[model samples]
Target: MGIVVNQSIKNTFITFVGFAIGAMNTLFMYTHFLGEDYYGLTAFLLSSANIMMPLMAFGIQNTLVRFYAEHQTEEEKSRFLNLMLVLPLLLVVPIFIGLALFYNETAELLSQENPIIFDYVWMIPVIGLFMGYFEIFYAWVKVHLKSVFGNFVKEVLLRIFISIFLLAVHLNWLTSIQFVYSLVFIYFAMMLVMAFVAFKVRKPEFHLQFPKDKKEVLLYSAFIIFSSGIAVLLLDIDKFMIGQYIPIKEAAYYSVAIFIALTISVPMRAMHQITHPITTDLMARKKHEELNQLYKKTAITLQVVGGFIMLGILTNIHQVYALLPEKYSGGISVVFLISFSKFFDLMLGNNNSIIFNSKYYRTVLLLGLCLVVVTVGLNMVFIPSFGIEGAAIATLISIGLYSIAKLMFVVFKMKLFPFTRKTIISLLLIALTFVVFYFWNFPFHPIMNILLKSVLLAVWYWFLNYRLAISEDINAVVKKGLKFNTPR
Candidate 1:
């Protein structure tokens, strides 16, 4: 918990900084500098690429973490590491060739509903290729328990570059198309920087040999691809399908609301960076008792943290939307639905890592595959009828259903659950906080109003949690921060 607390706090701070920058870009720069149409196209391109990444990487990032902890000798570790490095190429190279051969057709297909996508369609696979490798190298260092640096780069660096690119467009230095191309270069740069850092963390010990459990490794990677692919799909597929079914500008509108809601998940993302490897190690040693404890702790901690953010957003959302441009204001409902969906996801804690590292991972994979179909089907029905709001509804339903299934499976199969008495108490506290502060407002600027309300809300929320000691880990950190002695 020491390392988890230390790194997760730092990572959470860094991730918020990134999201802050991204919010500025999404809310102000993209909307103000670039027109809504191009903004949507940019969002569409990035979402499509993200959906492609897990497939291109072939689940090597997860496979690396799971197997790295199990291997003992340096020689054996090197072979396993080398195998992880090369496995993605088996999928990447063919995909690259296929994209090249069918580039025109692919663009044509994507542009049928929104022809604005044709010019930039080529960047999807190219960016996905780089993004996929970035995760692989990022995971390489993560196994060594060196996650902060990678987390900084993963969360911060690329967004900083995007901010610059957006400014370049405002300065009349880069055309909209050039700005789109610059994203490809930016992703590639991140891949190179990550590769260099990974090597510095542990120099390449490439071997042309296979691990003793080569068959098992390949099988895990093969099946884990579906699991990882399904995860990314659930996250990104909504935006992609929006581009297919609706006008491209609607995608931009949805992206803005989705970004606002996604800020709630920053803590979960930060915790997962460190918790994933630890969870893998725990399962490798079959520490079921400790695993159950970690599962509950993570779930409750994330719920408390995530719940605070969600409450802030839900309470302040009207004022927040009042500040946005008229074109993007219709996504108010999108924000509410998506924010709750993310909060639900956060409550699952490290459920994905737990299942992926366990022997029952294959069963989870099958469930994920089925959910993928359900997600697409729901999006197909909802996006056309309800528009962006419908897409958000579809996402909430699919993700909520999938999360429930995973939670039940973990509890039934492993006898582990991520809830306790404090879980119910925390839920009541969140509701009470929202109801109390939500109607309270200041006769000031929207920005100032949000700031005042959020500060008050956070102070009130944490004050009660601390007094009640909802989470020991959080209570310990809070007490230390305040220079107060811990209670026995």
Candidate 2:
């Protein structure tokens, strides 16, 4: 727990910095520099690539984390690493060949609704390939218990480079079209850098043979592709389909709102980088009691942190949207719906890490496939009727239900539950804060208003949690920060 808290704090800081830069790029620069059409196109292209990444990476990123600790000897671990590295090519090569073979058809299908997508369609696979390998190498380093550097590269470096590219476009040093193509090069460059960093961390002694549990390894990887693929699809499909059913620019509107909502998940994302390997190790050791405790601690801490973020966003949503262009203001509802959905997700804590690494992952995969079908079907029915808001509604429904199912499974099958009395208390505090602050604001600029309200909310919320002892982990951190010599 000490290591988890320490690394999570570092990761949270890094993610916050990265998201701040990204917010600048997404809200102001992308909206101002590139028109909605091109901005939406950028969102569409990246969402398409992300949708394909899990498949191209062949779930090996997850497979490595789950199995890496099982091998006792350095020789066995090296052989396992070699196998993990190469397995993705078996799937990626065939997909690339197919893409090349049917490039025109693929472009045509994507551009059927918006011909603007035609020119950039081919970049999807190119970017997806690089994105996939980036995850693979990032996970490789994670299994070595070194995730902070990789998190910096993924969360910070890429966004910094993208900001530079956007600035290049603004300066007319390159046209938007050239900037688009430059993204492909940027992602591939990051992939190569991560690969180098990972190898340097623990130089793999490459081997061709597999461990004795070869069948188990292969089966787990195969099933994980479906499970992890479903998860990515759940996150990105709404954006992808928004482009297909409506004007591509609607995706831009949705993207802005989604980015605002996704801020709530940053803590979970930060914590998960370190907690995932720990969850896998605990699960393998059958430390069910310890795992359950960790699960509850993470859930409450994330909810406490994520819930406050949601309050901040929801309370200042009107001001936040006022800072955006008129065309993006309609996405205010999109922000609320998706913010709640993300908060729900954050409350699940390391539930995903547990499920993905458990023996019941295959069962979860089956359930997830069913939900994916429901998500797509709902999006299809809803988008034509409700537009961008409809997509948000569909996502809310699907994700809400899917999270429930996962929570129930973890409880019934594993006898683990993340919610505690403090969970309810935290929810009440978030609600009370939102009600108190939603109608209150200063006669100030939008940015300053947001800053002031966020600070007030943070001080109040953290004080209540600390005073009430809603989470021992959070309170302990507070005590340490305040230099209190308290008994454990």
Best by TM-score: 2
Mind giving the per-residue lDDT tens digits that candidate 1 earns over 1-488?
A: 57766777788788888888888888888988888888888999999999999877888888898889899999999888888888888888898888889989989999999988988887898899898899999999988878788888987888889889999999999988788779889999999999999999988788878899978888888877777788789889999999999999999999999999998988887788679868988898899999999999999999998998899999999888878888889999999999988899898889988987777877877888899999999999999999999999999999899889989889998889999999999999999998998899999999999999999998999999999899888998987877765455
Reference-based TM-score of each model: 0.89, 0.90
Cα-based lDDT for every prediction: 0.89, 0.89
Tens-digit per-residue lDDT, 191-214, candidate 2: 999999999999978676877877
Error of 2 at 301 (Å): 2.5
Model 2: ten consecutive residues of lowest lDDT: 1-10
List ranges where model 1 is wrong by over 4 Å. Answer: 1-12, 67-86, 143-145, 201-216, 274-290, 484-488
